[model samples]
Target chain A: MHTEAGPKRPTTPVQKGLQAIPLIINVISANFQLNQFSSLTLLEFALDSSVLLLVGGNRGRCVWATPMNNIIAYLFKSSLGKKYIMAVTGCCLFLFVIGHMVGNLQVFLGPEAINRYGHFLQSNPELIWPARIGLLVFVGLHFWSAMQITLENRAARPVAYANSKPVAASYASRTMVMGGLIVVSFIIYHLLHFTFQCKAINLTGQDFVGFTDPNNHHDIFKMIVVGFNQPLVAGFYLLSMGLLCLHLSHGLSSMFQSLGWKNDAYRPIIDCGAKVVATVIFIGYSSIPVAILVFKFGKEALK
Target chain B: MNLTLKVWRQKNGQTEGHFETYPARDIIEDMSFLEMLDVVNEGLISSGKDPIAFDSDCREGICGMCSLVINGIPHGGHAGTATCQLHMRRFKDGETITIEPWRAKAFPIIKDVATNRSAFDRIIQAGGFVSVNTGGTPDGNALPISKEVSDRAMDAAACIGCGACVAACKNASAMLFVAAKVSHLNLLPQGEPEKHRRALAMVTQMDKEGFGSCTVTGSCEAVCPKEIKLTFIAKLNRDFGVAALLGK
Candidate 1:
């Protein structure tokens, strides 16, 4: 019976220790070579693979059990677990969007004020790089779990209703996926236009990356003024902002509900509160494009 | 009143179902929706044809046995009403009505417009209970539940398990039903001991049964015969989160 067990799995504790030596070396080497391979990710991968090995250990083929493994299973495999992932990641992205809007609004503070803010952010690789990576991870998790849940939802009801009509669901709630997709497209374009400083897409026929201010800092204010001067770029920016706000209108309160922070007594407040915040964000972000393209706030500084 | 019904017809669970139209002539305005179907079935039986199979029990609306997705809305789109309670007068004379079963992967069609809802029973068995030994009746004020808590619990307990919430959801999610059941048991003093375990077990069972996840669309609450609040789902979420955190 002992010999019949598969050799792939390390059966005894001594065998497991022997197997772990190679894994430890792999983890260290991976950490040194792959800059993106964070220690936490490697540990998680190790835990996941160990679970697979234990379950496939050629005994009963039973699922490996542990508190941590249970937590992992609950988070990834269960419906509620997936929803929790969406909720947590959504909250992160929501905060990032607000911070981004606030950062963009620094443009209205004039050249020195906005340029200082931009330079400060750019100067801190330690602060900015981690943030960028974290944001990317959150976005990936949010979008992936969303697609998974949406596909499961679609499959749940294989037959289509002939004449279905909305009863209590709001328009924003119903169109989240569409709005999310549009906002994602907008993120790609926005990053290309501003962060990457790709002049070809900016439509202004001008290089933005090397332009320097009087203080020898990156002329972010000038870049913004020039970038938004193009009608098509500004229009797309404004459209994406609109879609982002629409996504937030339902998403903000729904986050609370999914996390179990909401109840009937505060239901009305949460609902209206979400809408009010969404509207405020919309106005705040939209002000940038409208000011640039219509009011021409920073055009004088550009010259 | 004369009405045209495009009803789903299937011989059994394995067969393909289709919409078979039948003229429901001279239906009394006072007749309930199920009663109208009964009359239609009488016609089919008299004409030597197969009668439409549907579920109805205690037409008084309390039992939650009747289910029909009429005109694309569960329970005929009436607010806080079940199919057995929906009167024919709610529909216009000469209007066309479309009827279908609770189309969900979890609730398979057993026959024409009738589905297997034992998925719910399994979920309930997974947790929805308070364990106790057989004994004499306990004192009414033994635990001293607050009036507010009892009222809230009663509101959740009002769900008749009609599966309208499932039918109305675009995703065919059973979040509302599970939420209602979880909340009804979770809020009481007697249930506090097993609260976390109940949430984890019931939610696990619900997912195992192939029901979809909640999107907080509010459609489920709107079609609920008991008018179960969406807050219960939030409460379930909270309870589940707490339970999972506790690893119960």
Candidate 2:
């Protein structure tokens, strides 16, 4: 299957060994030589030949050990491959969001519970930092791949349509970039307001109310109460949540489709599931601010 | 009726193109879109000017050769109808119709309104066919197929490679085209043996040709001359996943 029509000059021991395993060589070298040689020839050659030599066995047995690594590598070099990357990273971020929401829900359980939870997270610096680093990687990859694909898609159609009309795509799907930008900005604001306690909000300063729990913890419960009490801050959070909902409404289902998990039988379920999850997350997160502002449940916690 | 036409004119793939206006006089409501173009071309030739260049074959929708994005919609944006099948009655008299070629990186304009769609042929060559042996014809009922299955297969088989899906797509994705080809063959019993291989090969070729990824916009189905459904893209995705995981 090696299409090199020249003489079969096997120079290296690896080439000779590969020649002996004709069946395995044919299957591996045929498709691999055609497509993958351009980018991954050296890597695949060194890896596969070394593995074959290490296993030194009957040719028939060795033939079963053709390397599929190059095929995957080659597949990922294309636009579709980039999309698969985005889907995977997006799923990771989705999981992170769900986990964060679950943790935040402990705030409704009162000061001790939420403070203990916050203390548990902060106390494990090694685990928490590594998880944070991993999440940052996912976010970076998700954003980078998204930007790359969007630019490529835009370049594909340079000339704008004079009277364009969308038939199949939803408003949410079309506005993903806008919503994503809003969510990213909100995340920065969120980290500053709560996690870092940046000077912008000046939480510990005289201008803002500051409270610590009995254990002298950062009093995350009181901090959340004071944070949401500000109408502007609460309004920004509510608006960002709405945008996040819009982003996830399309993104969740699209992630499945991008990863090739969609089929006619389960398409409706996946689409509806995306909408439901987005709405539920929106309502769930929005409830905290609504309860703080309207019902004033956390007023005493702030004091 | 008289109609004003703003036709895009380009020398070739390399040079820039611009819109050139022309008046099509005494255009009857009965004339097909291509026939109206032909009349306008005849007038241009009689007046010692170069005629407009476009691609058309069979003058019916089946050929898939007639390609024009009229007023920003591929194949006149009429569902289930090609540019050749579009009649002049659809447009109002004295209205200016804007005609442009299929604008996608994969499809370069060879001239005015005619693009090189060989990228599509390359995708087909990648593995759009079954590996059946040549022999005497099998019995009519040799392969048992349910009516629903056959109809669905036929529905996918109706894709004419018109590139309207690409033209209409926001991303210029040919997912509908590739999906139709993959689904039509894979749905049949005769194509069962090479199902996984076909899916992998065709999708790989599609990406290699520089077509953008499908975001499931549904515009391709909306503008397809065959009205090919978007579900075929979903099937293609399914087959691609299975093939990538398990196929040789």
Candidate 3:
């Protein structure tokens, strides 16, 4: 009965949990690997299994569900579905960006204070990693869902148009993937430079040497100042934040539509508000490095 | 009246479309909007360039073939007015009028402003028709539908598949068009047999066509060009809900 019950889903928490485990494994394994087997090995396994399933489908075996038939309704039918997913993720991401910007704004509190804050964050590993994991999963899901919709859009129109003008899609809409990739890259490069110990990135200090950020608070703040004091690092940070701002401009309003929250009455007002908010928040963060650059080295600013 | 027209031109779907500024100097105020476009096309042809192609027929505003988005408003910004009935008098002399076809994911640009509105036809054909026998030469008013029901049906039947609702909606939702058909038929006793099937089939087809969902934005009604109320969508939602609950 137990063995038979395993196959008999649609009931029982145990069976549901069993069914759910593979999903969790698949989701985590699909992401950027931290250690152990490389992504390529997993890719080969996934490809081989999917192909086997495809070939096996020709026989009288059952497949879980028709992928197209199940999701096509939401992806194809309603603009609200698109807006809903975009909205939920956008709002969440916005909250995170705002929080991040606030944290980074500590740079203006003077080097010692900023360094102490960074130390506090570093010391609280138990708190930080879990938040990071949640953030990573959400970001992954948001991007995956977006990619699915964009692909569906392309499928509706197969013939390539060389001269066909795209509709009034916002800059954020068109640049979602590009901005996302840039941010992802920035995150990795940033972590390696400040958090992770890759030799190329850890030029200023030994990675993790300030261990829980700098107790005297001097070294931690000095490290951050020195990091931004470099014109090259400052430029990259500013550019990434610019992209994040552009993404938010479209993402906020678009997400509202996805979640079925927007109407003609509220859409325009919210869209404009999003644009203004995105610009302000992004510029607020970008201003830090610019401030550092100006106050510290504006006399030789361009130099 | 002198009219300067800025029209979107593209040779084909594969070609790039651009807004070309043209002058419609010495035009009569009484001519229908199509007639003004004809004058512009004539000017373009006289120069050996290709004439602009647009949809129109039954120029009296009944056929619903005239699809035009003028000055960022569908059907020249008039409520309950078809593009063909829109006259040159609506514009000032020397007005730089901009014209383009309805832009929506569901409606592809076939040529210039002419789109493949066959999508709407497919939706209707999916389940809009009633199952009736040929030999039943039924007497007039044999079904004895209530006056309110008949009037409502007539209102729904008035939809000419013009794609105006799509043009009017910000998300380009086709709910008004779909609702009109569903409501008109479902309101009558004759259509009761397939009410559930009709609603489901039409909605499925609509989604299949990539038309956006209805948020009851009321933009469709505001710029309907026919003043088709959004009650049809309400009727559709009710039908679908009942049908799904009944496990039909």
Candidate 4:
């Protein structure tokens, strides 16, 4: 659509298609001279138009023509923005944990049920790998943001108060970092125990329980049964589950507040909901080990 | 009440400071905290010693000039009273009370128990006002603001710029203070015209002031003399999100 014959002007079909869009055209004409149109300028122009569209009802032209997308992107660089990122990523991880627990709870149904579920997950590498990658990224963002916030908070109070005391914050809130560290360590150990099936460093020797089903899939039910049968392994899992409870208890409610979803009427309910979810996840995950060891519920599934 | 006072003694912003003990003798229970300090300073001046320096204005606790952290709690850990309103009756006779100034990088100690709080003023300068022309007063009923909205705005406007929120925050965050200003104006109809720009400018200035980020520990609300709610911080976050997305 450009009348100019310059090298930097829009020449691609994408640019031509973008020119056909009315909002982009309005933004381009409003923000730039016709002769100044370029591919980069068109992209910037589209971005500004989309921001206006998203916020709804343009009051007038933006005074500072600096791309608001850049400023909005710049928000994450600030400490408060880091908190927003942490809250968003924490929400993602929280959902994944609940989903993972629900999927694992199928073991209570029977060996065939749990193994079929495992096979269903392993058979679709395409879907599972991307999900795994997304979970990893969320973990990285959550941990990185938490670390940055913690370091900044530590620096904020260089000199410790001789008699510092917490008034409104809970014990879970105060011990978030400590509980988070334990949960991280537990996750690493869990992945090694189940996913990688690494035996060299296996402390409980549950790796000896590995079995293959008729479909040649790993017998996850047998592995879980044998694994939890060890008192040491069961005890460790229970302890880590407690730590996970603490971490999630605070992390869940704090995520809502950080995301600005809290209000006076619903805050107590949200807080109570967080506690319930954490408790349920704790019971759901720890129940498998408890049943395997205490009641031998999955003994028939073992080889 | 005879009391032992261990008060922070700072020379200036550049120098290190420490606590110095002084015996406050025969102090009465009815005396306000600042007035008790006044008595102690009078005795020190009579004895040819430099008097302890502290800040207080409108000792009735309205101006928010009294900034003190008593025994590791901002505003002496009182529920809804400023340091000036805190009375000696709160302490038992012969009790040892430790007092210090508001501690934050943004609020450097100017002297004993007095820090420069101009950082707050700078944040306020950065678009904390409606860009309206000075003119004849409009009728109060012309705007037609709902009582709920007006009351909320007034509640936010109740912030006295005390800087106690900053002192109480574990991160030394000023989010509550900035949120109070932003919500007070943004909730009103007059502030609607400049809402986006105002949120952006004020939050940018707050970050530049070297105050740490808010993690919503709720201590600021707990120690606020005016009882400003943490909900304002959430409202500020919502505004900043919308403003940042919309751009200025």
Full-model lDDT for every candidate: 0.85, 0.82, 0.68, 0.81
lDDT of 4 by residue, A88-124 (tens): 9989988898899999899888888899999899899
Tell me the lDDT of candidate 1: 0.85
Mark the 10 consecutive residues where model 4 chain B has the least summed lDDT. B127-136
Docking class of 1: medium
Q: Give me the candidate number with maximum DockQ.
A: 1
Q: Give model 4's TM-score for chain A to 2 decimal places.
A: 0.76
What's the distance in Å from true for residue A79, model 3? Answer: 6.3
Taking every candidate in turn, the Cα RMSD to the unseen true structure, in Å, is: 6.2, 5.2, 10.3, 6.7
Q: For residues A158-274, what per-residue lDDT tens digits would candidate 1 score against the true structure?
A: 877776887788898899999999999988888897899887887888989888999999998898888888888888888888888889999999999999999878999999999
Evaluation by DockQ, superior candidate among 1 and 2? 1
- Top lDDT prediction, candidate number: 1
Give the least accurate 10-residue stretch of model 1 chain B, judged by summed lDDT.
Answer: B126-135
DockQ of each: 0.72, 0.50, 0.12, 0.54
Report the lDDT tens digits of candidate 3 across residue range B1-113: 88777787777777878877788877899999999889988988999988889999999889999997887677877767899999988888777777887877788888888
Q: Model 4: clashing residue pairs?
A: none
Clashes of 4: 0
Positional deviation of residue B96's Cα in model 1 after best superposition, in angstroms: 1.0
Docking model 3 quality class: incorrect
- In model 2, the runs with Cα more than 4 Å from the true position are A1-71, A124-134, A201-211, A293-297
Candidate 4 vs. true structure, TM-score = 0.86
